[model samples]
Target: MRISLALLFAVVLQLPAENGYAQRTHVAISMNNVSVEQILNKIEETSDYVFFYNDKTIQKNRIVSVRNKSGKILDILDDIFKGTDITYTVVDKQIILSTNKMQLVQQEGQIQVKGVVKDAGGDPLIGVNVKVKDSTVGTITDINGNFSLQAKKGDVLEVSYVGYATKTVRVQNAQVLNIVLTEDTEVLNEVVVTALGIKKEAKSLSYNVQQVSNDEITRIADANFVNNLNGKVAGVTINSSSAGVGGSSRVVMRGTKSLNGNNNALYVVDGIPMSDMSAASTQPTDSYEGAGQSGDPISGLNPEDIESISVLSGPSAAALYGSAAANGVVMITTKKGREGRTSVSISNNTTFSAPLVLPEFQNTYGQTEVGSYYSWGSKLNTPSSYDPKDFFQTGVNVTNAASLSTGTDKNQTYLSLGTTNANGIIHNNDYERYNVTVRNVAKMLKDKLTLDLSFMLSSVKEQNMTSQGLYYNPLVPLYLFPAGDDFSKVQAYQRYDSERNLLTQYWPYSTSLALQNPYWITEHIKIPNHKNRYMATASAKYDFADWINVTARAKMDRNNERRERMYDAGTNTLFASKYGYYSKSNIENQQIYGELLLNINKYFVDNTLNLTANVGANFENNDYQSDYFGGKLKSVANLFTFGNVDTSEKNLANQYGYHLKKRAIFGSAQIGYKSMAYLDVTARNDWSSTFKGTNTGSFFYPSIGLSGIITDIFRCSTDIMPYMKVRVSYSEVGNSPDVFLAIPTYALVDGV
Candidate 1:
C-alpha cells in the first residue's frame, strides 16, 4: 500500500516569445479530499512557475478530489474546473487565474536577466530578495545567490537583505549582472549613553557599552521585562529564576566579583540609582529555596515607557558612580515628549507558554503494593495511562497598553496606561500588574532654562507562585505518584470528616515523605503577595552659554509590600497545625536622591582639540522597615487572622528597620584631539554612614582611559573596514562594607 508522490512540474528553460508555454508539463498527484488552495501550493513548491491570483477570483475553499498520475497541466485544470467559470492565462513564468480571461504577454523589449548577489566580502548571500522596481514581479536568490527574471533593458532591479542596505541598479545592455550590497553603518553607529546619563560618541568610548532598543524589549512580551534580555548581549549572563512566572532574573556582567558581598549590577533610571529591596540575598552556596525569591524593582516598570537600555560592562565605565556600581551598571532611559504632531497609540499583546522538554518515565512497572509511592514491582498488563504533564496547564499572559503624546515647540507632554494579567502552568497561580506614567518637558526664560518632570505608579498582586521547592509544591507529589493507579480518584481531594466536623484531605497513601494529594495542596495552601510603588522625578537645567550649562535633579522612589502564607486545616502537620497556620509581613522602603552638576564643552586650537567634562555632587538617603506577626490559628479552621493566634502555643512578632545616608562628589573629563584620539579621566570621593566605629568612612576612586581610532589615524577607506579602535584603561573601584557591621543591635523575645 505504498504510493509514491511525484512532483509534476516544468523546469526552467529559455523559450520562444511567441509560445504561451513550453511543452505541456505533466504532474502526478495522489491527494484525497483536499482544497484547491492545497493543490496550488503544491504546484508552487515543486515547480519553477508561480501562481498569482486574487482571493475573489478563485474558489480557494472549495473541496475537490484530484487523482492524476501523469496528466498535463491543461488536462488537470480542465478536470478540476469542468463546470466552473474559472479561466487561467500563462505569462512568461507567472500563471494568472481569473473569472475573465486576461492576456498578459511579455513586452517586446523584455529579456531574461540573470544575476548573482554578494556581500562586501564577495561571499554569496542566500535568501536575498530580488525584485523589479515598483513591480510585483520578484524572486528570492537561490543557494548560490543566483536569480533570473524577465525584464526590459531600461527597468530597475532592487536587491535587499536584512542587516544590509538596499541596492537599486538599472539594467543596461548586459544580460548578466553581479550585484554587491554593503552593510548599513548608520543603524550600527549610535550615540552611547554612559555613566550619569552622559552622551558621548561611540568611537570615543574606551570601555564596552551595549545598548538595547525599546523595540527589542517589547517585541516578545514577558511578565518580567528583564527576561527578554537573555541572549541579546555579549559578555553578559542572564539567569531566570525558577520562581514560575513574573520572577526576578539575575544579570551578571563579566563575572562574580564579590566573595561575600552583593554582585548584582546597579540599576539606574534616568540618572538616579534605585534600590533593589526585593532582591534575594541567598546564593547557591547558601541554603537555597526558590519559593523565597520574589520580583525585583525593575519588574514593575512598563516596557513601553522605556526608550533604551545601556549596559556598562566594566568598572572603567562606572568609576564615576562610586562603590554602588562596582560590578557594573544597567542604565535605563525613559521616553520623553517629542515636539511633533499629536498622536495616540493603543496596543494589546497576548502570549501562551508550555513546557517544551519533559522528563521520561517508565510506565511498564507498577507499584509493589497498592499504597506504595515507588513503581518497581511486577510488569503491568496494560501500560499506565498516568502522565505528569496532565497536572500542568497552559500558561497565559495578556497585556493591554495605551498612550497619548502631544506637545508644541515650548512644552511637550506624554501619558500612558498599561495593565498585565498572567496565569502560570500550576493551578491557582496568578500575577497581575497595572502601571500609569506621565511626563512633561517645558522651556522657560527665553529657552535658556529647561524643566522636566515625571511621575509613575505601579500596583502588583500575585498568588501561589510556586518555584522549585519541595514544600507546598504540587509537582513533587504529581511526579512521584504510583504508576498504574487511578489518578482521577484523587481529583476529589477533600471529604467531610465527622470527628473534626470539617472537610479534610482525602488521600489513602503513606505520608512519610510529606506527600499530599496534589489537587488538595493547590486549593488549600495559599501564598499571596502584593506591592504598591510610586516614583516622582524633577530636573532643571539653565544654560549660561552654548558650551556650558548647569543641571540639578531630584527623585523620590517608595514601595510598600505585603506578603501572606496561609495553610488550611487537615494540611500536612509538618507545615500546618490542626487548626491551620498563617503568617504575614509588611515592608516599606523609600529612597530620596538629589544631585547638582556643572557641564563644560569647549573647543580650542581651531576646533581640533575638544574637552567635555562634568563636576557633580550627589546625596542619597534610604530608609527600610518591616513588621511581621504570625502564629497557629486557634479554635478555628481556615480562619487566617492574626488576632486568632493560640496563646498557649509559641507566636512570632518582630519589628526592625535601618537607615542609610551617603554623600559623594565626582568629576569626569574627556579630551579629544582631532576626533581621532581621546583620553578619559574620572575621580570620585564618597562618605557613608556605614563607616561607623572607624576613623573615617570615606574613600576615593579614580580611573583613566585612552583610545585611538586606527582607521581615522591612517585615513583608510571605510569599505574594507568601517571602524577600528585600540583602547586601554585602568581603574580602582571598591565595594563598601555592609551596614551595621561595625555595630550590634538587639531585639526583644516575647517581651522578656
Candidate 2:
C-alpha cells in the first residue's frame, strides 16, 4: 500500500523534533505589583527562559499578581506557583527554582580573577589594595592598574600599597594577574610628614625634617619655587629676590628664629595655613622710588601643583604648628585624587636667561660733562661704543602645564592648569601667570568615610616692575648711561612735546634725580602689578576604628592686590611732580582656618609596643587691608586718578588696616619599640589676638623626642649597615607681637 504510507510520514516528523525542550515556550504576561523576582523576570523576558533560584531558596520577596495573555511558560509558572511552596524545573533553558522540593545548584569555588598593579618602574600602581586573602574580599587598582575579583583557584591575593612592598600571590589557575610592587626601602626611609599633618617615623623624628620630592620640586623650573630650595636643605636658607620674573623668595629655616619675627618659612599648603604675607614691597627697605618686591605669598605657588616638600626644620620640627610654626615649617604637599583610570598630563617649559654676571662697566671712560653722569670722562677713542651688553635683553621663560586625574572605587578627581610667560632682561619687563587647580576625593561609608575638596585659582600680571632704589628703576637709567651715550639713540624713548601737549623725556642726563629715561623708564615710568588668588579646602575623615581616626579641616585664603604707579610730566624729578605722579594701591588678604583631628594607632607588646597619637584643635582668622591714594597729578599729563590726585600735605596719601586672631590646642605622642626604639611628644597652646590680655597673651609650646637604632642596637648588618639612627630633641616655639604691636597705634598724620 505504497510502502506503508511512507512509514507514517516519518513517524510524524520525529515527534515535534524531540520534545522541543519539554514543550511550553510561548509566554506573554502582564504584570502588576511585580516581584516573584518580577515573575521570574517576566518569565525570563518572554521565552528562551533562564531562572535558577535559591537566593535563599526562592520566595524572592513574594508579591506577584500576573495575567498571562498567551502562556505556556508552564501556564505562567502554574499561575506563579499557586499556593507558593515554590518549586519549578524546566532545565533545558534553565528555570530550576526551589523552595520545598529543593534542587538548585550553582556554586563551585567561584572564580573570576583579573589584575595588574605595577611599580618597580613599570608604572601603573593606582590604588593597589587588591585583597582576597582573609576574607572581606576587596578591590582597588583602577585608573589603569586594572583589577577585578572573585577568587577561587587557590585564593590568597593581598597586594597593598603606600610606599609599596606587601604582596602575595597564589591564585593558581591564573585568569590574569601581574603585580610588581617592591620599594619599601624601609618604609621609604621611615616616613615623615610631621607637624599637624603628623606622620612621623624616621626613628620618631626629633628635629631635622627635610624631604623635597615631586622629583625635587620639578627638578629645576623655578619661577620662585622657593628659589628651588637653594642648596637643597640643611638648615635651609634661600634668599632670592633681585626682582626678576616674579621675585620674592626667602625661606630660612633653622637659622633666623625671628629677631623681629617672620623670618619666612611657615607656608603649609595641604594641611592649610598659608600667607607668607609679603607685599609691603616684600620689605627690604631703602625704597628706590617706590614699589619693588611685590612678590611673595610663595610667588604664587604652582610648582606643577607640588606633591611633597616637607622641611619642618626645627622647633623640634615645628611644635605643632602654633604661632605659624614660629619660623620653621614649609610643608606643602598638594596634588591629590588618585584611585585611577582617567589621567592626562602635559608639560612644557622653555627657559633661556642671560646675565649671569654683568657689572664690570668701564668703556674706557668718556663723558666729563656733556650732559654727563660721569663715567669719569676722557680717554675713549674706540672703547666708548658703550655696551653694557647693549643694556640686557634675552630672558625668556615659558611654562605650560596641564593635568587631570580620574577615579572610581568610590570617586576621585584632580585637575590642574598652568601658564606662565616671562621676559625680563629689562625691556618692558613682563611676567604673567594663571593657574587653576581642583581636587575632589570621596569614599563613603564602606570605605569608612573620606572626603577632600580643594580649589585654587591664581592670576598674576606684572609689567615694568622693578623698584629698588634709583627712581622707578630702569637699572637706574640703564646704568647711568653716558659711557658715551648712543644706547641705540635712546631707543626712541619718546618725543612729542610741542611745548607740553604730551610725551616728553628724551634723555639728557639728570644724574642724582636718580636717573630716569632708560627708554623713558620703560615707557612712561609705569608699574602695574596685579594679583588675584583664592583657595578653598574642605576635608573630612572618619575611620571610627581599626585604630581610630577623625579629621576635619576647613580653609579659605583670599587675596587681591593692585598696585600702580605712573609718573609722566617730564619724568624724574624724583619721580615727576610738575603735576604728574600717580600711585594706586589696594591690598587685601584674608585667611580663615579650622582644624580638628584625633588619631590614634595602637598595638602593644605582642606587636612589641607602638602607640602614636594626635589630638588637635585650631582656628585662625586673619584679615589685612591696605588702601592708598597718590599725589601730584592734578593735571600735568597722564591724568591717572585718585580723582586726579593732589590732595595737599605734600601729597602722600595712605591707609592701612589689619586684624588677626589665632587659637590653638595641640597634642602629639608617639612611642615605638620593636620598630626600633623611639619616643616623641608635643604640646601647643596659643591664643594671641596679638596678645589680647597680656602675659604674652597665652603661649606654651613644647616638644620632646628621643630615638635610637644604632644599627638596631648592634644587631646591625642590614646587608652591611644600611641605616643607623640617633636623635634627640627639645623645642619651645613662640612669636607674637607685630601688627600694631600691642595695640595703641597711630600714623597717617597728615591724612588725618
For each of the candidates, give the backbone clash count.
1, 5
Residue by residue across 1-752, what tens digits does model 1's lDDT show?
Answer: 00011101121132233133523565666566868877776666566656654444578868888887765555566667778877665546555555633222223455456678976645466556788998988776653567767676789998976557889989774335789988665554235579999867677788888888788899988988988988988888887766677777778888888787777788899988888573322121123222443556688899999988999988999998999989899999998776756889899999999878878888899998878898989999999998888888899999899998888778989999999899988887888999999999899985779999999999989888677666676887888888888899898899999999999898888888778888887899888889999999999999875568999999999998888889899998876788898988898989999999999876666446778899999999989898888878788888999877775666477676889888999999999887679999999999988888878679999999999989869987488786688999999998776778768676556768
After superposition, which runs of candidate 1 have C-alpha atoms over 4 Å from their true positions?
Answer: 1-186, 278-290, 368-372, 745-752
RMSD of 2: 25.8
- C-alpha positional error of residue 240 in candidate 1 after TM-score superposition, expressed in Å: 1.8
Model 2 global lDDT (CA atoms, 0 to 1)? 0.73
lDDT of 2 by residue, 253-317 (tens): 76886565668877888777786485354653355454465456767878998877888878877
Candidate 2: worst 10 consecutive residues by lDDT? Answer: 1-10
